[model samples]
Target: MENQQNDVKYEEEYIKNSRGVELFTCRWVPLNTEPKALIFLCHGYGMECSITMKGCAGRLVKAGYEVHGIDCEGHGKSSGLLGLISNFDN
Candidate 1:
């Protein structure tokens, strides 16, 4: 448990879906050599899941889980901005 907190591997700004409005983007931080589980978080609209999610993710990570996130369409670095995301599936 304590050891897991020490090991953190992250791949930031990775793409999930990239059509018109990609519905996902995340900071993948591997918390352990052998994670017990994977934690995925989808944030609120008009906002990315990087700030507070980082804190929550860190705690889960320390508990030996692979922490990940998705910034629903019109949010983070996924793709399209708000007020312009057509009828695309995000």
Candidate 2:
């Protein structure tokens, strides 16, 4: 398994969703070439993707795939309250 940090590019950013909540997102991409595929990851409840998924993302990136992850609203570095909310019930 490839795990060289230099073989991949990592990035993090925050984006505001339609509800105006800021969400944390991160991505890992292979350097110098197009990725073989794209993979999106969603962390489980009470989990965040950045630190928890770093190793997994790195390996995928070095293997020629692009990986992306996001912190759901209220989880990780995102804004809002913890636990689930029924936003669609309004």
Candidate 3:
């Protein structure tokens, strides 16, 4: 889905990872100009990208950067046992 906040555009999607788990991903991009750079956001443990890091993403977008984030396996909207990392290989 897509939405606009001020001059930034926000979008979210779900994609299956290599392990076949559906992961939630989101991005914020400057709507009126080419982004200066790309920023990949990494949320803390037990934190999800959309809600937890939204403000940070917005700030970056306003600074002329595109920000992307993801809810890792077993966290947030991702499909897996909550709080379980198992292994990082996947």
- Provide TM-scores for the models: 0.68, 0.86, 0.94
Q: Rank the candidates by lDDT, best first.
A: 3, 2, 1
* Model 2 CA deviation exceeding 4 Å by range: 1-4, 87-90
Q: After superposition, how far is residue 3 of candidate 2 from its true place, in Å?
A: 15
Candidate 1 local lDDT, residue 87: 63
Write candidate 3's Cα lDDT for 1-90 as tens digits.
999979988999999988788999999989999999999999888878999999889888888999999998888888899889777784
Against the unseen true structure, what C-alpha lDDT does each candidate score?
Answer: 0.64, 0.85, 0.91
Q: Which pairs of residues clash in candidate 1, taking residues 3 or more apart in a chain or in different chains?
A: none
RMSD of each: 5.0, 4.2, 1.1
* Clashing residue pair totals per candidate (backbone < 3 A): 0, 0, 0
**Model 1 bad stretches (over 4 Å):** 1-5, 16-24, 83-90
- 1-90: candidate 1 lDDT, tens digit per residue: 112235776555645464654555555456336888788886765777767587887777777787777776666665666635566663
**Candidate 1: C-alpha lDDT:** 0.64
Question: Model 2 misses residue 53 by how many Å?
Answer: 0.8
Tell me the deviation in Å of residue 34 in model 2. 1.1
